[model samples]
Target chain A: MRIFFYSVQSEWLKTKNSIASWLCLVGGFFIPLLYLIADIKNKTFINSAGTEIWQTHFTRLWMNMSGFLLPMGLILASSLITQVEFKNNSWKQVHVTPQKYSTIFFAKLAVLLGMTLKFFLFFNIGVIIAGTVPCLIFDHSFPKENIPWLYFIEKNARYFIACLPIIALQYLLSLQFKNFVIAVGVGLAGLIGTFIAFRWQYIYLSPFSYTNPFAERSGFSENILLYATIYFVVFTIISFYLYVNKKIKG
Target chain B: MEYCVQTTDLAYTFSNRQQVLDNVSIHVPEQCIYGFLGPNGAGKTTTLKLILGLLRNHQGTIKIFNKPIAGHRVEIMRSVGSLIESPSVYGHLSAKDNLRIFQKVYQCPQGRIDEVLSMTGLANTGTKKAAQFSLGMKQRLGIAIALLHHPALLILDEPTNGLDPNGMVEIREFLKLLNREHGTTILISSHLLTEIDRLATHIGLINKGRILFEGTAEQLKKEKNRETYILYKTSDNQAAAALFARQNIKPALLPDTIKIAATSKENVAGLNRLLVHNGLDVYEITTEKNDLETIFMNLITD
Candidate 1:
């Protein structure tokens, strides 16, 4: 366990100056900053609809985010973070370390998950800033209801869960292929294919279709999260098998 | 003798069914500088990779510290540090940052980072990203990381490939110091005979997916000295040859020189005196012995 923790820490350090780090900070802030600008310019806070204003703010944020940016951000972030080893030609070094192959595999996957969570943290903070800044700028009467903290947290957690299959699949692709374009290309094509088949009766078969349904609160089975969980587990198992049994890692 | 690293009949074939190593076995004695010498594509790097557990599914077993490497790889690797083929370095990180990452992984003392940096002559490279470093500097940084944990066995494959002569000398000296003072066993590989000849106490020479020689450097020297000859440049080559012929010594005549297989140092001296007594100007009488390069060629061709 100590070795595993150390592996995770070391893996995190490799993310320094990588494109994944930039994508996290920028991906998190881009939507909120755009919303803040639009809201401050339009002065929508002056005609607030009580508690619904908070719901409206979060809904719009998730709508724009979950439909496109969230899945794409995960694909790019996971690939970039995983590719750090390949790009630096340091996979041989990583493999030669005293850690178990399982530890190395999971430690990197954990770091990628942590990066996603950091992206969420930054994006949520941005959401708050976007929500409050317009009211502050125009000095309009603030919304008359308390923030729905529990509701927003629940939605964010669910959306994060929904995006897991994408992360796992992309992680697998990046680990198997040294070329960045192939990993990113396969992920983008999968997401685009999900979008094209979104209206199918059995669209729930695809994990990528979950985030949009969960965000819009429509077009999904009640077992949607369960299906996402199953896909995440299946992909993760396949990834673990490939990584540990890999004959030539470095 | 207790060996630090032992491989028995280790063989490997690539995915394409191209065999890279064949029945290659090497024994690196504890606390000795074991040089792995071979030409390019001589399976040197492949053998090193197999020993390090970077390449798996081989036909033989590797034992480090007398324990099988299959089940105890991580435990064995804790005491082993390696730099295989090229220097494995993260280009964007500074030397200090790079070492710090490995330090956390190895869970070694933070002070050891500075220790290895200065040891590899990279302590002055503060805040300079490794990507901007010269090739030699990056190679040094790679070596520093390998040495960071103070492992008992250091496996380096062509560690001197990119270094300037001065850098190479420093690394050679540092490796020697590491082995002598710390009792660390080293298995260094190189294609150049002179490179290994200066440093190796023991050598394992490989070529064409096979090990041709494995023994002490002195034993390799004996093999090189098997065929010794003498060359003579005189004021009169014909006169020197005529003198040798008269003395019942067959000399191979060349352009302005006479060559003969040397039987003993005393006989060479006697021949020189005979030339001088015969009123011939023996401008040069040079005894020649085969070097490791020639020995390597002979081994390969054989």
Candidate 2:
């Protein structure tokens, strides 16, 4: 257990030192800043818009930001965590340790998951800032009907839960490829490919398309939750199996 | 006494279908600096990997500390430290931070980080990242990491590959200190004959994935008897050989001189007296001992 914590701490330290983390922070703030300016201008154009307009704008901004940013954040985190070992050819160093493989594997997984949570935290703050601007600039009263704080919590929880599989898949992909570019490229290509496949409506069976669970008002369907749970469990098992069996050569 | 590492009929083939290691067996005695001497592509690194369990698909048995490497791998590996090929370090982390990270892996006390730092002479470069370190410093850091856990066995492959002469001497002295003080069983592989000759007590000379010879340096040196040669500028060469033959001594004939294998300095003087008595003038006499390079060359060439 101590080994696990130490590995996790090391992974977290690397994430903190990464250039990708700075880019995520800058990009996170920029996205919400742009949306807030656009929403303020949109409110000024309307003659009689109420709190409902502001609430809808807030939900849309949060959803859109998370839809794009969270996956990218996961990709960055996964790539960063795996790239450190790959770049320095330190896999042999880690493997020769007395720590169990599961402990090391989960430590990296935890860091990737934690970074994704951090993105959500920053994005939430951005959402609040974006929501506040329209009310201050246009003297618009916030819509109480769309401000379902409990629903917002439940929906974000489902969204975060849905992202677990992508985190696992990204970790696996990054581990499979020593090059960060290949990992990130494959992740982006996967995201785009899944989005395109979802549009065609032919491969609804694909799990990547279901990465975003709270996009609509489905209110966390039992079916989607079940599928996501199975997907998460299956991919987690497969990724760890491959990692444990992978040959460590310097 | 039990061996620190023992292998039986080990073989490994890479993905390119090239046999890197054939059926080779090696025995490393406990607390001895076993020099794994071989040329490039002689399967030294591959053998180390097999012993460390870093590479699988090997058809053989490997036992370290009397434990089967495959069954009790973690338990056995915990007591072993290795620096294979190059130093494995996080280039972005400071020297201190790198030690701290490995300390966690070894589950050692925090003080060990400082201990290894001082031991490897990296104590003064606390804040310097590994990328900024010189090759010798990095090699020291690598040794520091290998020693961090207080491992009983250290397996280093070409530890002095890229270091300068001073660095090599420093490492050699340090390794000697480690062995003398801590009794750490070191198995170091290198092609540098002089370094191994100076350091290793027992050497396993390998060639083409096979053990050519295994013995102490003295034993190898003793394998060939020291032959003495006499450079006699004699008046008649054939008469000199005829005289030695009549005296029951076989003198080897060279282009310019006749050589005789004298047993000792006294024997050389005795032979000179006999040659002078027989009317042969001896101008110069030379003798050479079998050094490691000559012995190694003889072993490989033969």
Candidate 3:
């Protein structure tokens, strides 16, 4: 367990100047900054009731996030994190370390998961900033409705759960193939396939469809989060198997 | 003798069914520089990879420090450090940062990083990202990383592959000093025999996936010396050849000298005595031994 911790720490150092780190910070604030601009320009919050204002704000935020940004962000983030080793031509170096293949695999996966968590943290903070800036600039009274902190937490947690399978699968692709284009290309194709099949009765069977349906509450079953968890586990297990059993890692 | 690394009948086939190694066995003794000499594509890197456990599902066993590498790979690897092919480094990070990552993995003290940096002559390269490093600098950083944990054995594949003469000399000196001072057993591979010929105490020559020669450097020399020829200049070269012919010993007669196949020093002495007894003054009897390159070429080519 201590060795695994060390592996995770080492893996995190590899991302110091990498694109994945930039993706996390920039991706978090990208949408909220645009929304902030639009709200301030239009005075959208000057006369709204507190509850109505809060509801509208969350709906707009979650709509973009769960529908497009989160999935695509995950696809890019996972690939970027895994490709750091390949880009540096250091896979053989990592493999020759005293750590086991399991340690290296899980440590990298943990860092990817942590990057997603960071993105969400920054996004939530950005959401709050976006909501308050317009009210302050327009000299409007602050919303009287209590911040629905529990609701925000639950929704973010659920969406994060829904995106796990995508993260695992993309990580698998990135680790298995050294080419950056192939991993991201396959991920983009999967996202497009989900949109084309969005209306199908069994579209929920695809892990890519997990985020949009869970957020909109339109097509997927109430057990969609559980299904996402299952897919994540299955993909993770398969990734570990392929990684450990790989004949020529270097 | 106790061995630092030993492999027996190890074989590997690629996914395309190409046999890269066939019944290749190597033994590296403790605290000695075992030079793995081979031409390119002779399975040197593949063999090293299998021994390092980077390649899996091989045909035979690898025992390092007398423990099988199969079940005890991680445990065994704790005492083994390797730099295979190119240096493994993150170009965006400085040499210090690159070593820090491995230090954390190896769980060594922070001070060891500085030790290896200076050991590899990289202590002055502060804040310079590895990408900006020269090939020799990158190679040195790789060696520093390998030595960070103070492993008992270091496996380096062509550590001097793309270096200038000075760079190669520096690496060679560093390795010799490491072996002498720290008792670190080194298994260095190179395609150029001359590169390791002066550095290696023992040698294992590989070609076409088979080990053509495995023994001490002195023994390799002796193998070449077995075909020595004696060229002697006498007062009468013609009579000198005729004197050996009477004893059923054929000598090649030249205008100035007689050349005879040398079986031993005793035989050479007897031939010289025969010349002098035949009223021919034996002036020079020089034994010509084949050079190492010739012997290496002859062994591998055949």
Best by DockQ: 1
Candidate 3 reaches a DockQ of: 0.62
Question: What are the runs in model 1 whose C-alpha is more than 4 Å off?
Answer: A46-50, A213-216, B230-261, B264-288
Q: Per-prediction DockQ, in order? A: 0.70, 0.42, 0.62
Candidate 2, residue A219: lDDT = 38
TM-score of each: 0.91, 0.82, 0.88
Global lDDT of each candidate: 0.88, 0.77, 0.88
Predicted chain B of candidate 1, TM-score versus the true chain B: 0.83
Superior candidate under lDDT, 2 versus 3: 3
TM-score for predicted model 2 compared with the true structure: 0.82
List model 2 lDDT by residue over B210-275, tens digit each.
Answer: 888887878877766553344555777788778777878888887777877656677667767877
Q: Where does candidate 2 clash, by residue pair?
A: A51-A142, A51-A143
Task: Give a tens-digit lDDT track for model 2, residues A68-119.
Answer: 6667776777787788888777888777777677888898888777777777
TM-score of chain A, predicted model 2, versus the true chain A, to 2 decimals:
0.81
Tens-place lDDT per residue, model 1, B3-36, is 9999999999999999999999999999999999
* lDDT for position A63 in model 2: 69
What's the lDDT for residue B108 in model 3? 93
Candidate 1 has a TM-score of 0.91
lDDT of 3 by residue, A1-250 (tens): 9999999999999888778888899989988888889888878872363456665687678788778788999999999987888888888889888888899999999999999999999988888888888888878777777667887898789888988999999999998999999999999999889988788888888889888834356556587788899999999999999988887889
DockQ rank order = 1, 3, 2
